[model samples]
Target: MQRFTVTLVWVCFTLATFPAQAEELALTSTRTLAASCAACHGPNGNSLGSTPTLAALNQQYFIQRMQGFKDGSVSSTVMHHHAKGLTTEEVTAMAAYFAQQPRQTPQPLPHQSFLGAQ
Candidate 1:
């Protein structure tokens, strides 16, 4: 019984400290694949060009937007070429990549309390 307990502890400890290599690998690959979009969008999906920014979008929002573009639900001749080229694997990677990026917080307007959701 004591040996069983000790082995269980060892197993749990090993599992707990196992390096999170998969996440790192995924991020590296995603960063590479998503690099193509960074010219128009800011690095890591922070949009720098003349379109709606993608940084800070919730993961779900990023996925939805990418999926829409892929499916033609969102129409844009300029974006179509880029979007159509993306595979589900690439889109998922992009969503994960952008989700990991730092989000831009809009500066609060002074007296926003008075603005009341305007």
Candidate 2:
């Protein structure tokens, strides 16, 4: 009984000291890192961007996009540059950050928005 109790106690202590599955930045840190990104990505992931706004996207979708960027499937001069530098952990954090942000409401087109123009 005494040996069993010591073993259990050590096991618990070791588990407590174990590292994370992967490093993940806190949301606050992600936000701080995102300040520069906000210049183009927009505050809270809502960009004043002429390209596309990325605010409030699903976490999975955001992760897919980041992975795409990392794989060179996604095209963007700036995104490529930035994405290349992101560690997988950082990418996950950034994705989580944007996922938590509010999405921007899309504006209706004034003219006919056609799928195809003849």
RMSD values, in order shown: 10.5, 12.0
Measured against the true structure, the TM-scores of the candidates, in listed sequence, are 0.60, 0.61
lDDT, candidate 1, 1-118, per-residue tens: 9999999999988777666666678778888887766677766566645766666567788778778887889877687677778888888778776777786644453553565675
How much lDDT does each candidate structure score?
0.73, 0.73
For model 2, how big is the CA root-mean-square deviation?
Answer: 12.0
Clash pairs, model 1 backbone: none
User: For candidate 2, lDDT tens digit of each residue in 1-87?
Assistant: 999999999998877755432233355677788666867766666765485566777878878877888899987677778888889
Candidate 2 matches the true fold with a TM-score of 0.61
How far out, in Å, is residue 86 in model 2?
Answer: 0.5
Query: Candidate 1: which stretches are off by over 4 Å?
Result: 1-23, 104-118
Worst 10 residues of 2 by lDDT: 18-27
